[model samples]
Target: MTSEELNSNTTSKTQDNALGPAVQLTDEELSANPEYVLEQTLSTILSRPVVCDEESDVDQETNALFTDDDDGDNADGNQRTSNENNRHKQSDSPQTGLSRWKPTLHKPAPSIYILCSLMSVKVLAENLVLGVITDLTLAKIQKYYEDNERQSQKEFAKFQSVTSVIQGLLGISLCSKYGHLSDNHGRVFVLQICGLLTILGSLANLYIYKDSTTYEFYSFVFFYCIEALNAGQMSMVAVGNSYVSDIVSEDNRMVCISFFMSIMYATIGIGPLVGSFLVKIFKGNSFNTLYVALFLNVSYTLGVEFFLSESRTVNERRESQSQYHNEVLRKNLRKEQAIFSKESSKWSKVYHLLKMDTLIDLFKPLKTLWVPKTALGSLVPRINVLILVIIEMFVGGSVEGSVQAIVTYSMFKYSWSSVEIGYYYSISGVGRALVLLLAVPQLISFLKRRNYVALPDSIDRIDMIHLYLFLIFVITAFASMIVYETNDIGSYLNSLFISLSAFALPTVQNGVIKYASKKSIGQVFAAMAVLRHLMSLIAPPLYLQVYAATAKTFPTLFLYIPIILSALSLVLLQFVKIVKDHDMLRRQSEASFNNFDEHINNYSVNTKPNTSFDIANNLKNGKSNLQSNSIPIETTPLFKKSHFTGKDNIRNSYKSLRNSFVNSNTPSSKNSSLDKLKAQNFSAFNVPPSV
Candidate 1:
């Protein structure tokens, strides 16, 4: 029997079994011919286990039985085949093949890597310099006030508090402005400049103090500027962070940023402790220690310029070359085509590209608490920013306040000399350094892994973790303060807890800031600077007010502010949940789009014309027109149509299944889709044949 005849008999039997009866329709019988119709009905229904060319042909008797209406349907079948061939030709066009060359992931040059590393070093150096300067200057100023005995103790105390307030305000302003500047210019360039300024400022302060005996207005201005410069050093760190974001992929960014931040905070902790010990070695001449800080800053600046290469390539250069080549090629190809006399000017194109209106729209984040959802409809990225701001504000403010308070408290209460305060701060610095160098980096790495595995969808887990850590430090610090106030805890324990809190505070603050800054380095840093400054503005007054209010009964009135702040921080933690949920959904949507785009790209690239039909005809006719070396065409199934009836239902069902899976997965939903798809398909195919 022929292939057509065998196909007809099989179709008749299959139809008989499925529908319980078979009618004698000529069109149906013709479609049953295996050679002409290719088992159209069954191929359409089953849509799987497709037969290739090598498969055995249907029996001849089946073909004869289905030959009644073959002549009439022949023209229609040929037309359908021609239309499909046309579509296949279009699908195989060069335009479709061009889709293969999509934007692939590119790694930044080695110089960028070197610059990033140097930036990390600069962060450490600046923190160290700040610690050394603050400790030394405060010590000298306090001693001078004491020697003169010009003012009463209460007045001196108030004066010192006022100095702190002024310093905090100035620090906030400088840091915020520089942070914005670093966003505009390259991070390395701005950082190098900042480092140089720090070195100069430190040296100038050192030189002026050595010869000056009288306290003058210039002295305060000089130191104030120095303090401002010190605060502005943070901008350098911000610039480094922005660079990291620019270089790293989204998948690997968190780990790299977390490592950088951990190192930065670790240095913050160690700087003071090292400075204090150094102060003891230098005796009472704390001013001399400025030289060492100056050296570190200058060295870091020089190292950056010499070793670090610029990460940002000029867009104008790339655009000019691309446009030149494209225009030349186009002109060559279409010599007869008239060029437009008035094409839009380049400046106009640039103006439109700049989108000043859209740029202005971004400013809303600064003024408002509400975060805009990204294209993927996820709020996680924005929530991550908010959480960072909150975490930095409370924790950053506390650390700055506590550090100042410790210096003042040691001087007034313990009667420790400049050397003693420096020594204590240096020890605290060592603890901080250890955390940054060893403990914090490891902790950040672990947290990041947990974030990827457990909360892969959420971008703000790191921020949330930071908030929790900040709360722990705040509560512990407040409790220690309370104990000290009530005379229930020893001075040793109080000092130990205070030092520990200071060390831990920066870790939490840096972690959150680094995490948020991972995506848009400059913007996040700018926003953080604004928040930190706001905190600085509030912290001094709030501390003073609380101190004044509780001073009559409790000597440690500063303790209450932390408790209030800590409680407020906990409230902020609730928002983290909202942000995280939004981010996860956004990521899933983005991943889905990316996968779809990739599939389309792959399909477009791989599609080609099937020349096998022409070759087969040539072979049958004994013609020699075909090329002997031509690549073999891959055979595709003749019938492409399948039962699309349940597609929408399947999608809906799958969506529902995915939702359940996500809910059950909780912290980690990474594998839920694969598991759900497999389970659904397995159960679907495993069902027994219908009776």
Candidate 2:
């Protein structure tokens, strides 16, 4: 019978069995058979004949079945399939195609790099502006209250405390809102908005000084907004950090993150120094001096937005989806695409892409830490989190809190102009930047090398790195305390100690994060944030209370907290050993292949022969190299094949062998030919342990 007649009879038989009614077989049904399916589908979809020897019998029948009326639907499917095939082809094409568009060394796209550098500048500018203005305003207000006969000193003290409390609350609220907005919008956009608000608020403060009575109420409002803007600036920092994390890979994160932080702290030091100089320039006209800061703030924001490329691809994709949604036809088209793409749904693609799972993942570390360990493996990650949290709390309470208190205290006690204060801060900034840029990379490289030598097969070396960081913090804290307490010390000596302390922080912070369990990175970070905010909340009130108690005596009561916090941190450093033990045991259990010696010996001996013959044999035989090597020893099959077989039997036997080779080759083709050969070779050389 002809191929068409055989196909028609098969379709009739299938219909009789299934539906009890004979039905004519369409070209689609004839093409669905295993031998012709792939070729027929490719030809119909690509609008070209698919070269395949196996499909020769059905090709004539398929061509005859294609009519003018069906050509439209076929053409549409073919166009779609062609577009998809082109995309696949493009992706599979060599990297050489992209080489022409690759950035040259000389004509680099330095905007992103420039933006990264400016982040340090922003950190310094924001803190400096906040410090100088807050300090100067509070000082002037205190002096006014003390000199005025209308206001009691006691009442003034209460008013100052209340104002600070109100400012703190405003800061918290604004920071939280800014974080939410940053997630919804983007880091650059939110930062720009905050910058504009800062400029407007500063200008308002300037106007209030010129027309004190008319703008009195508005001035207070502007100052309140400025406090909120300052808090919003903190959110910008968190956004910047999140953005950096998104762009940087985990392996090289420490050095990059340390550089980022070093620049920020260095800027922090420089900002106040510059502000102090500006204060002298404006000479008691604090409001006028702030205008210069306002200008810098606005310019920084504009520079960032215009120059800094968006780091989040998911955010960019969501934006595209939103823009596409605006057109009714495109929205429907997307819905259809969603139906075909099983991986993502229409609504979910937008929502999932926009959601920052990294931020959400921050909470996981905390949950992992809190869970009771069922085994030694479980205990290590949890203990690591505990150690990291302790470290974060100690540093957060001491360095971060003390810096804020000192800046405020110095402005009040020394009567130093903002310009003088800014100079000292700038020195500190320069020192911090130099230390972080120079020291951190060397430290990380040393730690990596040490890990290789000490524990070649350990995943727990990250924990040892964390332990080393704790030791560094301990030394930094001691040096800082000694420098601050020694009155005979030169200004440069004190500055040197402070800069060293700032430099140690990034290494310590990055170390804790690097060693942290992956699932809980976000939560651990959030918990660290909570610890920081809590300390921030407490430090101000404690400083104020100490100042109140020691008003007539030494103003050094404010410095007492850093010294005490430093001592407490040293006490916590002892717990690092407990974490180290847990890490070692965990790594031992997780080590998959303990018989490294035998595997190495076998691997070396088999290397050459395995490469030459094993892969080629496996490819030709259509059998995995891991399977039995013994060929089938069938005596009857030799004589049976030697005699002349029926035409049907010969055709069937040849068809079976062809199908097996085609099926075997098709899946392996998904990977590169070289990779497939390597995999086959490796499997052949490594014998599985006998059951």
Candidate 3:
């Protein structure tokens, strides 16, 4: 018999024996098999495929549950058969054809080396000029006061305090602004803008340092104000860290962070040596470091502008901007509807939009810290995130507060020159680099492999350990400085050999970021930056003032502040809780299920047109060729075979279904089934009910 005759005969046999069978099938099986009488009836009525969990194959199904398997080796045979079947199906799919045409236009992402290099250069440049700023200010103070030592120290302290205050106030807004901007525009855009600001700040530094004799002390203040613009180093660190977070997965985030931080520490160690060398090259001119800094800034800025690509994708930018605009539109509509129902004045609308409440809304980014619950109202304890942020801010500010104080203190106590300060930082930098590059990674690996530390808890545990080690070393160093009248700089550098605490910054950041979503990362970092800047604004002046007051009688008294801050941070550290990796996976699954529910209300299937048979004529003639000899046209499945599949396809399918339903001229009775399908509970698709 011909193929068409044989297919029709087989289909007729299945339909005729449907009632006489000893075993029975449910409505779902009857609806799924096109050869079944019930499916034919339903398809004839609706001319649409019924939604089912899977297609039923009745040919291989047996009434007997117990089958004679050749010593259970048949199971292996069946598994092999299934694998072969899958391979055949994959071979027959259009994916094979599509896979052949690989796109050559695709470019590899820029190396992490570039980012590391950029950060190192930036750090080195800043370090090179760090001592110059203070020294120049002191020089101007001395020139003004005719070498009056006590008055010069007092003025220098005030200058430091005023600089911190101005920088802190401006930095908070700038960091917040750049964080939002990076989300919308791109990371590279923020990086480039911040780089240019750094360049300008460097130029201002060079100009001021070159003419300290010609200009007054206010020039240094102007330079410091310029440094605060666009958040300066704060913006760079936040945005750079954000970029690293974007490219690396959570699993390797710590390692990547450690890698870059090691580079930063290395530069910190080397920068002073280079700066002192350059000063000597110019015959003891501290201003020479400013020239090198300017050069490095220009080079790095150009490299960033030309070589670096935006980390945020086009789709992400569109989605983020869309949500923002939609939110604004919604708020405007609500306000107009509520207050301006009778009033048609434009000024009223503008005033309502630009009120003080709206101004206060700018700080809404800080809400990332207190993520009280998920979208579905599941409680997510993120208090640890807040704790980590406070710890970082307090610790970072305290560390920064030590720099100027230590610089001046060493100058007064040890009679150290600018070159000696350079050597001191260089040694400390080497110690820190060794810890981050070698010790941190090894310890993490050892814990994960040997101790079987859970990945989520590992970071928290390691961070705490590092913090403890840092605090211990810091306390010991300060105690020796205060208790013993240590005149030797070597002893100070020797005490800092335990710079293993250098791992604390990156690890703390890594742990805090575990609680953030991909979209909110920038805002979270920005909020942290704001807090750090606030501390910077507060801590420096306090340290400087205390040092100035005690410089004559008790120079070591200023060392107590960092020890206090470190102790407080360690106390807070004990309260932080670890979020397990599996819990994160569960949250992701819940999010995906939520998305599916949102899309399934309008779910659709797109059927391919059959060239051999007419779908339109089959409907019109009250017939279906799905069980006929003619090739059956297949409907495209909801989610096809793609590793990167997501909700975009679901949304598109929903739109297609809606359009087809609206444009169809079918009878209302036939369309009723489609409407019923839309209204059916998600359980119909065998999807588990959400919690």
Candidate 4:
């Protein structure tokens, strides 16, 4: 038979069956079929045939279960099958042709690398001229002091030192703002604007370079502060981490985070080397080198604008859906030649932007960070995760503050030069890159394989095991620092240990981040940055003061402070209550009766589609179909499908007579007998019930 005829016959046979309405595909069989449906839907949408990946067939089978249609219909086996066929018919839709909007980077890797590189370049450039700018500013500020050279330079140096920490604190303080901007506007937009601001600030610094007056110096400082305050870098980190998390669902999050972080860490290491090389090339002409870096920074901004795609979840999808809906409505209205009425006006739209609804959305990240309950009244890890994150940040910050102290220790103890100091700083960068590339991934793999670590993504909870790992690294770092020596090998070994000890910090950072509500990742990171920045403010001054007092006499005593702080953080982790997301509670609420709630909801919606109309039409059709196909037969000789049993044997003796009457169909006599038999049956007389 022809394909059309074959399909029609199959449909007719199934539809006309006696139990057609009651029959259903078994769950296992039904489960096997959604890929065929999703493949059809995507084919319709993208205008290209997409076979669901072979390895993911099992996973994609469940994907359709989660994906509901625009009209909120959760497709079932029969509905999905029908929808697939319908989509096949409409595959020629013009929306499917997207050649004009083709993206440059078809994969995640290139985009991630470029973004990380841009950030790396920015920080690298800034660090290169930071010292020259500081010294120049100190010279400018020296005029206010009446004391001799020693007093003027000393006070200015301390003040200038404060600027670095101040820049950090201010930048960290604005992480939240830029994070909001990233989410509301776009990550790349945040990058571009912030990069431009930095460039402008750098230019301002250049123009005011020779100004020995206090006002111009402060103006330069203020502009530079503006540059740091809008720290596009930290915002990018949060956004980039989130973006990578979204794209890579493979082997948990370690692979994606590890690779991206590795490249980023390597750039940071290479930056100093580049900066030192540039320093030599410029031969004390810091301004010339600064100008070159500024140019590259601008170029990076342009690259960000043109090349990087926005990584926000809600903004991108919501805007696209809105546009698509409008396009569809416009097309339909045009075809019908109907008036395309506008909703309210542009003024009302503008006014709505000021409404409380917009305000609530603006503060949703805050709510997600501070509030315990989520929008669905589900539990979130607002308190516990924040506490742990704070601890991590404090410990990290205290350790970070030890940088200058270590430099002091190196200089006073080992007599290291400027170039040697740069090399020393680069050691940590190398160590960090090594950890990112090797240690983090291996550790995660070890823990997961052993099943000691909870699945962070699935449960949305931080495992204490991660905390314990962080502790191990911290202790190891402390041990390495305790072994600090004046020799080159000992110094390098100390640096290596410091790096190894920090192996778990980034993992813990990513871990605590996961523990937070996915909706508030940016805000959580902001809070984290603030705590770190706050620590930076506290520890640097403290470390510097302590080092200045004791470095020549007892340099290693300074190292003990971080070790103690690390130990305290480890103890604090024990108190941190690791709250999981409500995923488990939700699962428990649903698992009984094998998804009964979902089934009931689906059934209610299915049975009540335009309740009155559907009830009337569907019931009538159901009744008719049930009635026609469900006629019962009597155990008589005329009914060949029936067999004689009990009273049927006796009835069979009279079957020939009954058949003679039934065959003749004398209307008056036969109709009454048939009607009586259909109405009721008795054991005394062999009578059949109605169908």
Candidate with best lDDT: 3
- Candidate 3: minimum summed lDDT over ten consecutive residues — where? 57-66
Per-residue lDDT for 123-223 in model 1, tens only?
Answer: 55556556555554555555666755444344445545666566665555555445444444445556666766767776666765564544344465566
Candidate numbers sorted by TM-score from highest down: 3, 4, 2, 1
lDDT value for model 3: 0.59
lDDT of 1: 0.47
| TM-score for all models, in order of appearance | 0.53, 0.55, 0.64, 0.59
Q: How close is candidate 1 to the true structure, as a TM-score?
A: 0.53
lDDT per model, in order?
Answer: 0.47, 0.46, 0.59, 0.51
lDDT of 4 at 463: 43
- CA shift of 70, model 1, Å: 54
* TM-score, candidate number 3: 0.64
Candidate 2 structure quality by residue, lDDT tens digits, 1-691: 4446655664443221110122223444433332222222222322321122234323222322232334535533544464466456443331121223544223223233565565655555555566555655555454556656455455445545665565555554455444444443444555566666666765655654443433133345446456355554344445565566556676656566667666666676566667667778878555555667666666766565555654544323233223223433554565556555788765665544554433433232244335333223445444544655666666546555555555555556555575655555566678778767777677667867776322211224543554445445544543543455444232334445566655345544454454443322333333444445556777666776676677568655665555566566566655553333433443321222123222222221212122323323323332232134322212112113321233334234333322322322331123332233234332222212110
Q: Clash pairs of candidate 4?
A: none
What lDDT tens digits, residue by residue, belong to model 3 across residues 1-691? 3335533643433321211221233333322331232223222223432111111211211221112333224533543464476457434331111123533233238556788887788778887767667777688778878999998888887888778677777787688788877776677777767677888888887776665345466767887688668685666778878888888777778877788778877887777667767888999888777878989988877677655655776545544555456567777787767466765567666667577446545565677677544434434446667776776776667766676677777787779885676566666678889888998888778867765443542245656666677666666666566665666543355336436467677777787677666666788778777777777777777888999998888777887777787788778877766555443423322331232223322322234223212322223232122223222223323223331132233223333332332222111112322343344311122222122
Q: Which consecutive 10 residues in model 2 have the weakest lDDT in total? A: 14-23
**Clashes found in each candidate (C-alpha, N, C closer than 3 A):** 24, 20, 0, 0
Candidate 4, residue 240: Cα displacement in angstroms equals 2.8
Candidate number with the higher lDDT (1 or 2): 1
* Model 3, runs deviating above 4 Å: 1-108, 133-159, 206-220, 284-290, 327-364, 374-380, 402-420, 451-498, 544-574, 579-581, 584-691
